[model samples]
Target: MTTIVHNWSMIASGLLTTLVISVTAYAGALVLGSLLAVCRVSPLPPLRLLAATWVTVATNVPVLCSMILLGLGIPRLGVHITLLWAAVVAVVFSGSGYVCEAVRSGINTVSKGQVEAARALGMPFGLIVRAVVLPQALAQAIQPLVNILIACLIGSSLAAAIGVPELTNVTRALNNQSGEAVLMFLLSGLVYLAIAYLATRVGSLLERRLTRSQGAAR
Candidate 1:
């Protein structure tokens, strides 16, 4: 309909915002998640307990509840977060737990002898983690991490519930005002598909690069 044509730009803008939220959240999750995973595997009981608490708390809380708390509660604390930031933080918190577990599982797949070999060569813990352990573990974890990224893409939609004006929100607005429900939803679906396709492609590329390096070393 003419209304759909007239408001196409708004829909596009919303989709772009959604994309940014997902990508930023994915990056933040990776860093925080790596730290959590390390703590979970640490020998110190206190550290492991703290890490497990993070996993349990994050997994138990729904994204909607977390977003409402962050988006609403932060302003009262004089640390006002824009909807964009609130949604980003919530998604990171939601996905980071899963990412941490995946990384731990990947690390488990790595043989202990690799660390022993690194230590036998007088390699420091930092170098062993950076040059030996992390590389292999990341390679093994690529698939599950990609799955987390996909979850992020879907979770980004939750921002709309918090009035973040993400893709679905814009679609709803456009459809309600213009009665072009089918067109707006179709466009929104395509945007999601594009994001999913890109995530999958990047995962495949990383897998290939890691595999090639692994083969070269062997």
Candidate 2:
């Protein structure tokens, strides 16, 4: 109790770091993944090759190795970055690979008629995606994206290895300082579970709202 009270601020700092990394990583992953997902379906062979190669490389490589290479080695090539940024790179890279696949799967479910209708209406490719395709794909894939977010949250803990001082790192430090191992772990676990729960609930609500809107339209 005493140690927890004394070290609360330190723990909070770590939690804040974790939150920052997770949110940035999730956002970056969504944008990168969505683009790659689109590319994976593009007509151009070169674009398809680029998207395929990116997904393969990102998925195959160990995230830690990717982090070290991008965060540390890239600096030698004049791309200086902090550890947090490094973790962001790794998370987004890995996350986008998974998300690209998921988004592509969702895209596959879109009817050919829908795209044909959009083209017949003289809608540009970009406008069609913004007004129709993205919304549909996102509706179908939101659950998987939320699940990926959960995985990314857990993975962010690994950033502590490179000295990011996220929630897990603070827990470790507090554990060593206080010797209240069980309670400390329980607290940290609950925090993680709470975060995951909130994300899941938000995704579920969005899905339900979309379903209802579709029903209303019909």
Top model number, TM-score: 2
User: After TM-score superposition, what is the CA distance of residue 9 in candidate 2 from its true location, in Å?
Assistant: 0.6
* Candidate 2 Cα misplacement greater than 4 A, ranges: 76-78
lDDT of 2 at 126: 79
lDDT of 2 by residue, 1-218 (tens): 78778888998999999999999998999999999998998878999999999999888887778777876788899988998999988999999998999899888888889999999999988787778787788889989999999988988988877778899989988898888899888999999999999999999999999989989998
Query: Which residue pairs show backbone clashes in model 1?
Result: none
Superposed Cα deviation of residue 8, candidate 2 (Å): 0.7
Q: Please estimate how well model 2 matches the true structure, expressed as its whole-model Cα lDDT.
A: 0.89
Model 2, TM vs. native:
0.94
User: Which residue ranges in model 1 land beyond 4 Å of their true spot?
Assistant: none
The worst-scoring run of ten residues by lDDT in candidate 2 lies at 63-72
User: Cα lDDT for residue 24, model 1?
Assistant: 98
Q: What does the lDDT read for residue 218 in candidate 2? A: 81
